[model samples]
Target: QKEVEQDPGPLSVPEGAIVSLNCTYSNSAFQYFMWYRQYSRKGPELLMYTYSSGNKEDGRFTAQVDKSSKYISLFIRDSQPSDSATYLCAMLLYGGATNKLIFGTGTLLAVQP
Candidate 1:
């Protein structure tokens, strides 16, 4: 089974709506979790970063991690059309010589005006 599973959503929402995206993992060794937003044909930029398990909120975006359940989620408040992008969830396992981020299949988000 894949270490991480995400909804790979073309999740559609109205501009000003709240959007929630998530991923579940089978691996419990992950020590770091992150959320990245990538525009079409562009590289992803870090949106949120958390160590272990916790919730971190930034502007309209919130990221949460549950180590016990091996689940993570990203919440976007007041969605905008410009927010349309692919959201990626990534994690790092501790034993590697260097942290190699394992990423999920991105979830595509579209905010319609």
Candidate 2:
């Protein structure tokens, strides 16, 4: 099984709507969960990061993680057309000589004006 799994959704929403993105992982060793946004032809940028199991909010974005259930989520409020992009869920396994990072397939989102 993949360490992290996310629905590759071409999800469409209207302006000002709230958007929810989710991912599930099989690795209990993951210590850091992050959400990244990637625009076409651009590199993925970190949007949110959460350590352990908890929630973190930044501006209109909220990221949540549940280590017990091995699930994570990202919520965007007041969606805008500019928010259209691919959202990737990533997890970091910290330990050993080197840390490891794994990413989901990514979910595509489009917000209409």
Give per-candidate clash totals: 0, 0
lDDT of each: 0.91, 0.93
Q: Per-residue lDDT tens digits of candidate 1, residues 30-94?
A: 88898999999999998888985788899999888888888999999999999999999998877
Pairs with backbone N, CA or C atoms under 3 Å apart (clashes), candidate 2: none
- Where model 2 places Cα greater than 4 Å from the true spot, the runs are none
For every candidate structure, what is the RMSD over all alpha carbons to the true structure, in angstroms?
1.2, 1.0
Where is model 2 poorest over a 10-residue stretch in terms of lDDT? 92-101
In model 2, the Cα lDDT at residue 5 comes to: 94
Best by TM-score: 2
Deviation of model 1 at 73, angstroms: 0.3
lDDT of 2 by residue, 2-100 (tens): 878998898999999999999999988888999999999999998889996888889999999998999999999999999999999999888777987
Highest-lDDT candidate: 2
What lDDT is reached at residue 105 by model 2?
98
